[model samples]
Target: MELQDHIMHGVFHSNGFGHLLCLNGLEAVAGSNLSGRQIMNFWDHLCNALRARKVSLNDISTKRGMELRLMHGIAYKAPWFGSWGYKFSRGSYGVIQPMYEKAIDTLRAMPLCILVHYLGSSNHDIPIIFSRYQMLSDHSLTTLGDMFQFMLELKTRMAEENLLDSYTGPGMFVEQSCRWSPKRIEMATRAIVEALKRADFRWVSRQEVRDAARIYIGDTGLLDFVLKSLGNHMVGNYLVRRCLNPVTKVLEYCLEDVSNIVPTQDPKVKTTIHQYRMSKSQLMKDMLYLYKHILKDYPSSLNVGILSVVPTAVRIILDAKYFAKEYHEDQHQARVEIGSEDKLSVYCTIMLRNNNINIEGTTTTLPPLLPPFECVRLRRSATFNELMVEVEKIFRDLYWGMKNLILDSVANLEANGKDLVFGQVEVGGKVIFQGSNKGGIGEEMMYYEGGSNWNKVVVCGCGAREDDGERMVSCDICEVWQHTKCVGIPHHQPTPQIFLCKRCENEIVTLPAFP
Candidate 1:
């Protein structure tokens, strides 16, 4: 049947403007079997009336008549109109929210197959159907599934063109409204919800969806609410760190904080804070440039800033530990020895100095070592083994570089020492470094690696096994590479790194874990 005939058929016979009520009445009251005889009798009466008025089918099918009839029906069933006229007149694609609520509440809303019968047919009016669907944005699943297929295809195309990060799904949904016919808002909502179920698609919250719809629908209330909510929070830190590369929407939130962040009294801290502000100030320009790149088919040019804002924020959170630990541990020290070859070993001594960490007990024993004959003889022209020893030193140097940075920060805070005299035991051979004080009264040679080097090695000192049968070094989540004792983990076996490693631990520490 022609589109106008189908529409008029409902208008003249259906109780409401929407075919939903007519379809429901036909099934519930009239019975399951709709006959050709009943339909022909109705059409004959309509034709006779038209003939008496000298009205032609061609005139009846004209756009104006169809529109008038549709409008008339809509006006008659105002409560069930679903704002069909306003939506079409305004050129919007989404269904009215109230209409959708009513449709879903129907005793027998149009079944999926009946509603979709002409969807794949060429004669189907795309604009009308699309508009109707938008109005039903939160409608039944069958309609939603079709939308999922379309959205995924569109997203894939955008990604292939490298514009995926520049525009969000809701943004695309709104833009598509420019050409499509009106649809129920519930239907659009349902379509979007289903679309997000696909892999690589993220379902936005209802509020976000509503906001997007309102933008096209010209509802300022949602926009006002969103802006107000964002304004109340201290989101500046999270924005810069979490979303280093933000989209325009995210940047709007960031800009909201421009007037709030200010320099602190600490000069060093102020410098850092100033640098952060400067970076944030330029974020909008950077985002626009990124958007242009994605839109212009330069996908490779679209970097992390275009697609993510999480990792950098993670880095900031990780870096904050350096300050918090400094505030709490004012005085703590361990005996560190700097070796010529660059290796560090730590020992806790028994000294309780009031102001600093002190290790006064001299009971810890050390064994003597002799330089290997290969090291002495192979120094001039090194063999393969000697080459490996040199290579090992290079790694040690790099480690010391990192370690020194950590130690220098806490260098001045050593505890007091108590004088402990111990009886000396017989030495077996030549010592690596012997102290001048034989009774251990004054000082002893402590094994320390890499003097003036920041890359110091500290172990967690987890004896061996870990708590959950997970190996220490293998844990990517915690990254606790040292033993429990080395890292100050006071456990017999390896405790879950969660207890000691900064990332896994509940509290912050001075160590930089991400690096």
Candidate 2:
């Protein structure tokens, strides 16, 4: 019978209460027995309606329409919607009729055979139905077993089309399928191993390995499986290290030979080692340059006596044995002994006496000293790069220590109203301090006088020292010096006698005036 005829007969012949009653009371008999062909025709029509966008699955299952009410039974098994003889009194019937609503409900309670019939059919709309399986299952329209069948069929179809390799579907589905395929795991592992072997024992990112092996490892678990497979001693004796890629900053793997200390062909590792060594060597060269420049005769255009003490102060701090012990104790805790601090104080006193520079009543505190390592022992398996880093750290600490010592001595002499002077003694061609002489002592000697003070200078507005060779002018109000160029004053112009700094001018403008 035509669908419209069934709806007309069911709607018009029903009771006055608006409940649908089929013609000749056939609803009771029809609900008891639903045929497979009738169910297939209903699903086919629903699929066609869905494809044309005339009705959505949500509208069919949720709206109060006799034609689409059966979908609630099929999709959700809603008790009120699925109950026999329940009347849906709204929404016009689109494709389904009122008579078949009972039949569709009966089909909904049947076994999975009806689904098999629909899926196995040669209908062109089956693929569209397959795509909506997730949508159907999401609404509880299909069972777990139904979803399993859908996946199997979809995978089989993809394999038949030679599109499985290029299929970029959900990763969970691929992983589940791969998990059950032992042969695929083995092949992927072999490919990854070959890729690593070609990498020449260097670090490689996972994406790099994927491209090199031409195998898609979409998830970490699969890659982990391949790594575990490589760990088998029978496969290869590879030492695997998981480190961050220096360039990309991503986690990567380095598979190397167990016996090899370093990858000889890896330029990055070699370059890093060379950089560390060059840094250490450059630091040593700088230290020597500082010593030689300080001991050399000054240009007579600069302060020689104040600057000459810098090398001597550095030498005195470097020669202190207590400083060396402190550095060794800092690096190795097991070597620390009781009363170490007290012993360090005693050694400081001895070092001061040995230098013969007395600071009896002055505020000249000693600067903290860092030790340069006199001896270093490396393990047989340690790489040269590691040794270079350790040595570099030691030299860096010593360099900064020497710098701090020189600055501390100069500051103390300035604070105590004393000027630095060269002393009169020479030991091993390096001048040693006994006491200050009027005609000036040798270059390496350091002395301080009780009554001498150097000229006091203030920093300029350009954050440079007074001796920086920039032409400067002093503000008349605050007396703070500032560079002429920094204040927009032309160099060739004569200095203004009543110059005021920007800060003092702003302060004067901000002050309250008398009425």
Candidate 3:
């Protein structure tokens, strides 16, 4: 019930998550007692035509001709449709039936499994059915029991609180904002986070942080929203210090070769895969290089740009303290032109300021990039399902690409007469391919490791991901490992140095207490 509550009432756009899960639960309830057709006002018969929209059995739709074709949306990621505000949109809903039918064929969504589907392409970790353990991006369980136990405890709390109604679950009935404005987003965020804290929910906060993001783009340039929304705001000053190394390490590893990405049949396929991997590899490296050489000193420097699909063009600026300001364009301007893809865009310049995102002291103005450089591109879409399709396309291309790059990088360096090549990894440590000077790449994906909870996502939160998690140092104080990238420190830091995380730095005393 608690899981249902969480699924149903997400801040930005999560109805699809709840709607689908409720359909599953309703199916079981309907199955148990053939005569029990109604639970509260949610009638079992209502599911007659709607049931096709609700249940998981591949054949459930056989009772009716209607089928669901859903996918994950990038903003407020839920299994959404083609256009903005799709759930309430008839235009958007029309497109989903065909699209969702193609994507939601995973095992948990199969048959009648009651797995907690998180909905959409979870940036950090995805929900796994019949398994509690979260398989890392490379597909390994990073933690055990937390995601599953969180559910058990949530159900217990709902029962104890006497708040568990057939119709009303946790946030199952809360109304989310029409758009994620900074104020509206922050309010929804505070409510969910506070509620989860009271329930003693161990994880899922980071996932919430991402889902309720306030930054946005309309037909106007520079979405007038909060910086916390534009960036990984969950990373406090302490985490920016601790996690920067891991971010660098991961980027470095991404440069190296990986192994065990699923293989294919032909040689030409292999070569194409190599180009994709190298292109991505080169992109990541170039991003890092630009941040260090140019953006590091000049925040207002117009030298930066990014390549992505968005209706409006905007720029963003961030300082250590999360200082933010916005510029705007005409409000009534039309969103889509004669031809363009439906998507959101966020941009910020690389500026370093202590309490100052604007440099006032001594500084040198670097020349603007001749071609207008871009660091990294952030993609946005109306639904995670569309994002998933694009992401799947990338992964399909990158799957063999990631694997081939790993192998080729190793082979190339070995042939070049390097002292060291590929490093063997220990069970729960960093996966590195070593060299005389920080060489070789390791596979980002690992296989799944089952945990105590057999029916939940392995882990929760954006921070719990294995790709970024291994290099991060946990704060003895707050305990959350921290989000990716840097704010308080340099992108690359010298290792073996004793450091205090920002929570400790600010003298944080204890963790939040349950109500």
Candidate 4:
């Protein structure tokens, strides 16, 4: 073959999957076609022939000498040429050859590219050496060491050039994988506590808490991270009471007095206590209690979706009934009764009063009210299992009509009685009814349709969702469900006959076993 044709063939052979097999020779030995073995043997024989003619292996492996013999041509300029060289020279040396010196040169030129791609404009260096150098295909410790050395030199050069601030120190290559920092948690807790206090212990919006925390933690992203990490534990620790605001439809936080909070191991008791704080009325409190009882007896009755809308549904019904009575003297009385079989029945009559008045020389005439003049009488009877379902349906049906009627009644009450507030109905400065329509019954109905899983009572120290199919172990002492892995039980091991969580085990003293 002509020299040009031989060079072309060499380029094709060196750049093909055959070259990949050589690069991954250790791994490919068991998998690749043995045809490569014949080619390598031929190269070995040719090298030995040159050695017999008194040509040294060093002279054969030199860059110009290898270029002449291997006929790599321009393919040697490629990024992986060093690896190819290592493969080609491996038959002669039987060790990692000088080709790695060139590979180190290529790696030295890669620090700026790696740093720019990984770190970008952020001064917060990602504290992982492997992550910083993940762009490189070769991840051996030797290659990593060279990469790290180059990156350090680059940092020093940038600093000396005044490209970086004098105060900026060396990038700590330690792994910082923790979700929350101590300083962040402390700052976030202080900010939230202050926000709750500013709201006079009333429910404060999440935005308010974030705004308060932003002063301490400047980065918006970091602030959110801290809040999310701490929010769940805050509720469990009784540091804050979190609830979805009925008016704003946003999550709100209220400070809890740790002294007044009762710690309980029962998940049911913990859930009830949380709900009790959220309940606005005695009826709501009772309904929640009864629902919990029913859920205990019939596990299938537990529907977190339905229960989430209960507060808004009850508020709507009460406000509609109250407005009906206030606007019309002859309004039908609203009645709520608990049956002997633990069923609840609600009867509410919503009336739209005629407001268009005409005066004719001492004779007054009022026009008939709008198209929905006829009163909407809503009545629902449901057992504990059906309570939330029935309430949700009634809310969807009566929301729009009752909302307008309630607003009109409030306006009239304010005009005549001069006692109504915009957001609340108060008597003797005590809020009787929260009358805000910011997130009214319509919004609540929409939220129900949107499939919100708010107020779901999750189990385990890890707070794994109830639907997640993790293997769980019920503590013999507390009876709370916990993931087997969380409680230190291996997946292959059979559950112990008696298992107690650390909390429960700490609470009860165990007698020492007799020898």
Candidate 5:
């Protein structure tokens, strides 16, 4: 509990999880003036001095506090990582440097026990606030503040990745009463009613808004929805954009009962109620589609631990713990408990491809692999082929399912006397829009995996002027327009569906029906 011990406590706590041991090892490796055993003994003393108080992840509810403690510990040993490798060495968090300097200056006299306790416990809120700032702040940093930039960037990246929730852990935002206060609940309800009015809707139809409020604020369903949406999105960016509306609604509803207003029974209110009902129905349908897509494509079976980076090729591994929820946890204790300690071991490994193949063939063929001359050996040739096949199968299933959903949505709009003129499909792979070119199916057009490419078809609007003698483009065997080279039809012989510079509008288009 001496002054030296107090400073050491702040220093150790700030250094993070295994800093004491890491430092000892580093000092020993460096052959510093202090011997390896002495370095280790000092670290041990520091750890023992701190272990007098036990803390767990649950003890820290805020990310900002957690980070402050981590930095406080790191400050005690400011010279440990040298200049470049320290993680929190820059940016808006340059605030860290002043704090570290203060800790160092004070450590010269502060008691070890008090300093350690303050950092290990009081500073726990650092991470919570720090993370929030990183997500929402845009403040520029001075030279001294440049060190904490990584903290800002890290927080931002994690939020975009939907990993923010995981980084902060559970119950950080959960209310102690297990429910919103009556005032909050009432306010939330009223907000829903007001939102409906702003949208030119009705308080009577506020039931849907109420339901949405319940899902978002009371039922914990909104978290799942937001997380699920993040599955196919860029996490941090997705979280920022996608969760904004839902979060706003939830906060409004829970903090301000805004959905229970009883407005005048105006004729416009009645009409707005009807429109609201229809829109609510459509929203439900869209949500169902999203839910199904998540269930089918990102099954619990596929939810394995994530590996952020790897320089060398390696096989992928999956642990059931990553994907599967605790069955007992989900069902609300409905299932019977078995023996006290019979934990099942469930783990699996999957092969991911690390190969590239070139597709080559005579002008008329669609060869699976690149031509022999162009083929290059891969690290895992067999595994790559298998992975390719699996990816293809997944793509096919996704394509068909999403295509149907798109068409069905369009059909539903048409049935409801609405326009489907400018809608898009929610597919994740190659787009299979009907097209005409010499190639069967014509051009294979699609946006690349990362939306990096914009491969789409463009055509002149109706009633455009053109050369009458120009070779007319038509599907070789169908009533569809196609470029001559797209259909694989020999230019010399114009097939029945093929046109030669001129054709009648009444010509019967024929070909196999689309799949």
Candidate 6:
């Protein structure tokens, strides 16, 4: 590629996915610029250009070489950049001005045009190495809490750079899909580990270190955002301080990995568990509890994508060191919790308000969700009530949304071979399952569907083997069942062949105790 094309490539790459990956150490070593192969070519071009000046160099991989690249915002306005640096401006990066002017002046005298041109062409972002968190000037990663602080600070910088709220698409939180590339992950991982080596945990206890690592490993992005961004949580000061307290702990639940619970193990072996539940219900509870309390005083935070953000946060807690392999039977729970949030967060958020009759500020008793086409007369200081309407509307949409999933799932099943049986009983003044299956295999709904997507959901409550066969049976009529074993039948008793769910069984003879 021509020099300009080369530069533009570097520039465009850095400003896009390059920068994000750089944040996570996912992109090339220096902000999103060139790959190793491309870097070598660019290096050679610079070396050849500077050869006559006797500034011989092997490559730009050296520490000094990088400083030149990182400082390109100032360094590149030098000789033989051939006015290209001034004449053309594209996506760009900036380095803070240094204390010494003469040092830069001396660099300007060198025939470093090729180097300058390369950096100017690619608007590469550099990884932020020097930050306030480095303990006592030890050039290393700080404590986990401090690491969060640094990330939050970096987020502010990203916002300033116009990277943070720039939309990529619907439901996409960040540009480049908010996923770091493999190479960038490796780079970030190495950097973090190496920096972590510099940390001194002498003042900290083992449990603290473990919890810190747990939170980070589970949901690094969410933890960082919550800690650094949300200052003074609802009625509580700085969310991190509130959550970090084990005494005032919020998201706590003992998760039992009951998926593999055999009748034999249920009697003999002692079961181990983690505080975070793998079940979707528990995940929803944890999330709702946290957001409800923390965002109460700052409800505007709820105005953001609660669905996307809540589950992400919950996943981090689940993935933490607290819940290792012992707590996860098939790792399917992880996928379910992450995926189901779009359906869950809507109703879950509104369900919490069922107890509070009035908005703290207004006399208006909360009303049902307003229709999108419907308008309500606004009163002064009715912000709290308006927020209530939004919550209600979201709950209405989501509650029905959960109902629709069963319909879609049943519709697809009927076309293929079956349908879901709607349970007659409602729980806690609300319909728990849209389809009637009082006692299913697990508490999990049998399937999920939207448009072209549909699949059976294996319930963990039923103690069916992991995608393996203990032989799950569905109702032949409506085909809305999965029973590997009877809920109360003795193991010594012979298992039946043709069977139906209680709702389905009602069509036939007397119903056996529902599984």
lDDT of each: 0.26, 0.34, 0.23, 0.34, 0.26, 0.26
Give lDDT tens digits, candidate 5, residues 1-515. 23322212223332122232122232223434553335545654554544312111111111211222222222333322222123223211112344444433332223322222222233333222222323233231111122133342343344232422211111012223434443343344333434333443222222445455453356444433322222111111111111223433532111111112111134443222110111323323332332232212223332323211110001010000011101112122122122224311111111112212223441332211110011111122123233223333433343321121111111112222132111221111111211111222222222122121122221212211321122335433343443343334576967554343223333334434679
For residue 100, give model 3's deviation from the true position in Å: 20
Q: Estimate each model's TM-score.
A: 0.14, 0.17, 0.14, 0.18, 0.15, 0.15
Model 4 lowest lDDT segment of ten? 165-174
lDDT of 1 at 441: 20
* Candidate 1 displacement at residue 314 in angstroms: 63
lDDT (10s digit) by residue, model 1, range 120-159 = 2322332223322232232222332233233323333442
Error of 6 at 454 (Å): 12
Please state the error at residue 258 of candidate 3 in Å.
50
The residue-by-residue lDDT of candidate 2 on 1-515, one tens digit each, is 44422411222111111212222112323443443224434543443333321111111221111222322333333322222222322221111223234433443343332332332233323322322233222122233234333443343344222422211111011233455364455456556766777885477776677677665555556665555333312122243345556778875655545222211234332122110111323323332332233222222333343332333332222211110001122323222222233210000000112222223344332222222112233332333233333444433343321221211121112222132121211111111111111122121122211112112244555444433334668789877766777688898997798998888899899999989
Q: Looking at candidate 2, what is the lDDT of residue 460? A: 59
What is the C-alpha local distance difference test score of candidate 5?
A: 0.26
Best by TM-score: 4
Compare candidates 1 and 2 on lDDT and give the better one: 2
Residues forming the 10-long window of minimal summed lDDT in candidate 6:
14-23
Shift of residue 147 alpha carbon in model 2, Å: 54
The candidate, 3 or 4, that scores higher on TM-score is 4
* Cand. 1 TM to true fold: 0.14
Q: Candidate 3 — which residues are off by over 4 angstroms?
A: 1-470, 495-497, 508-515
Q: For model 6, how does the per-residue alpha-carbon lDDT over 352-392 read when each residue is reduced to its tens digit?
A: 11211222354331222211111122222223234234444
Cα misplacement distance, residue 123 of candidate 1 (Å): 2.5
The local distance difference test score of model 3 is 0.23
> Looking at model 1, which ten-residue stretch has the lowest summed lDDT?
321-330
Ranking by lDDT: 4, 2, 6, 5, 1, 3
